[model samples]
Target: MPKRLIAGNWKMNGLKAAVSEAETVAKSLSEQSADCDVLICPPATLIAVFEEKLTGTAVQYGGQDCHTNESGAHTGDISAEMLADLGCAFGIVGHSERRTDHGETNDEVKAKAYALTRANVLPIICIGETQSERESGNTLKVLTEQVENSVPTDLDGTKMVVAYEPVWAIGTGLVPELSDIEEAHNHIRATLTNMGIANADEIRLLYGGSVKPGNAGEILTVSNVNGALVGGASLKAADFLGIIRA
Candidate 1:
């Protein structure tokens, strides 16, 4: 398997003082080498701050989201280029929150991913089935459609990360069974391969939604589950590190 990538999506949390937590995480992990890669995507307000804290450490930082346009009058939107300029190594696109709040579509997400690629930033594309869809036995179908439509057609697998966050499970302290997670990830991998994405098998697949230290180990061990897109647990260094070490 490829080296796992454990990334924390700090979402809209974390202030200036929160930089200390990131520093602690970097310090602790820098002391010991591991087989997986580590990253924290704080709120855009803290990206530059984390850039300083995470420097010279194994832990990297990314953006929560970016615009499809390079630079424009999209008031209140950050572009991939701006994020790259701020020293971001990766950018997240198509997160459920953005999809719901901004009514972002798959085509828009694909455009943003392509824009990030052009700016030398890897895009962690988020896709998941809603609670209703999952309850209706359409989880795989939803995921397939999202992956097919959201992922850029000319994507470079080396610059891509796919995170599967079951919409129902996020922040609700619930997770699908291990077997269910395995099936979802396996289906995602198969769908990517069928889509002709280069090195589809090499792409890192992450599981998200209420992943805590207690169950992180089991979740990470599931088939094709390379890492996690942590939420609340990531705010604390100890909790995030526990998951990373899991």
Candidate 2:
């Protein structure tokens, strides 16, 4: 069975004060039965600190992005090895924000994914379309190409996670209907299976964008959706836990 994972992405948000929220989340999950895996990706600056705060707790810390190189001259870039060293069991690659703002390409994301795999850090690869593409009926076309290029042929589903967060839906309060999410995830499953992985349904797929506590349960039950890639709600302890409960 696919693991139920609720991943909170802190994005560009988080400060000294935000550490307390993560501490609370860690405590809450630690105190409860571990039915679902709870992970949080704060900004790179908070990775080490949050890891320290999350020690001995069920809550795990992750990084929003990681560099392909294990060590290099890439200024301002964090690496998968470093994330693992800092206690991050997972990392997110190719988020829409990184694709749009960092000029990351499919091949670059793929390289990062492979690097994460080699470093023993799970990479949550993201792929989605913008409003324009959806308007033009190119959603599947875009998603297919991304999956074809972003996911490596050799990696098994256990090595990483995939998130489908339509660019427009991210941070925009606009989400695709349940059917649309199902279609995208289904297409992803087919694409992965064609690449030679069996039991691909056990691959964890997350729905990002506009995900909150209120709508989390409804979305989680969607076919093949293992959990969520939450954004805004992740910044708050209460809302983040609510989603985990959902």
Candidate 3:
């Protein structure tokens, strides 16, 4: 099996003061041994700052999002090349919030993924079904289409990560049952393999949505669940550490 990855998505939160949390996490992990890859994707503003603070530590930082164009007249947009210049090893694309707020389509997500790959930064692709889709019993169908459309055809699976976050459960303090999570992740894995991604078996599948320390271990143990795309709990050092320790 591939090494598990625990990534914290700080979303629109955190400032310079939050660097202490990264320091704290690194300090804690250094005191013990963690057999997983740790990543923290704060807002774009903190990526460079954390990059410096987290140097030589087990913890790494990434950007919450990146633009498809290497450079352009598009203002307020950060490109993958810029992230690479900042020493970012990973970049998140097609997150649920981006899909909903920015009206991002799967094609756009795929383009962003391609841009990230070209920059040699791993893309953590996010796909999920909304509450209505799940209620209508179309979770698998939605996930399959999203995976097909969002993931590039020539993706290097070994350098990619897929996160399944049920839209209804994100920040709602609700999570699917273990069986449900297992089914979604397994379906994602099978879909990626069917799409002919290189090193498909080495792809890491992550489960996101209301993942707290209380449930981190159970979620991580589910088949095909390589780790977590943590949200709220990841903002604090102690809370993030609790989930990491799990």
How accurate locally is residue 116 in candidate 1, as Cα lDDT from 0 to 100?
89
Worst 10 residues of 2 by lDDT: 194-203
Ranking by lDDT: 3, 1, 2
lDDT of 3 by residue, 51-154 (tens): 78998898988888999999999999999999999888889999999999999999999999999999999999999999999999999999999999998878
Candidate 1 segments exceeding 4 Å error: none
Q: Model 2 off-target regions past 4 Å? A: none
Ranking by TM-score: 3, 1, 2
Query: For residues 1-246, what per-residue lDDT tens digits would candidate 2 score against the true structure?
Result: 656999999888888789999888888776785578888999988887887778778888888888999999999888889999998888999999899898999999999999998899999999999999999999999999999899887887777899999999988888889999999989988888887865566679889999988888899989978889999999999999999988
Model 3 has an lDDT value of 0.93
lDDT of 2 at 159: 77
Predicted model with the maximum lDDT: 3
* Tens-digit lDDT string for candidate 1 (123-176): 999999999999999999999999999987567576799999999999999899
Q: Which segments of candidate 3 are over 4 A away from where they belong?
A: none
Estimate the TM-score of every prediction. 0.98, 0.97, 0.98
RMSD of candidate 2 to the truth, in angstroms, is 1.1
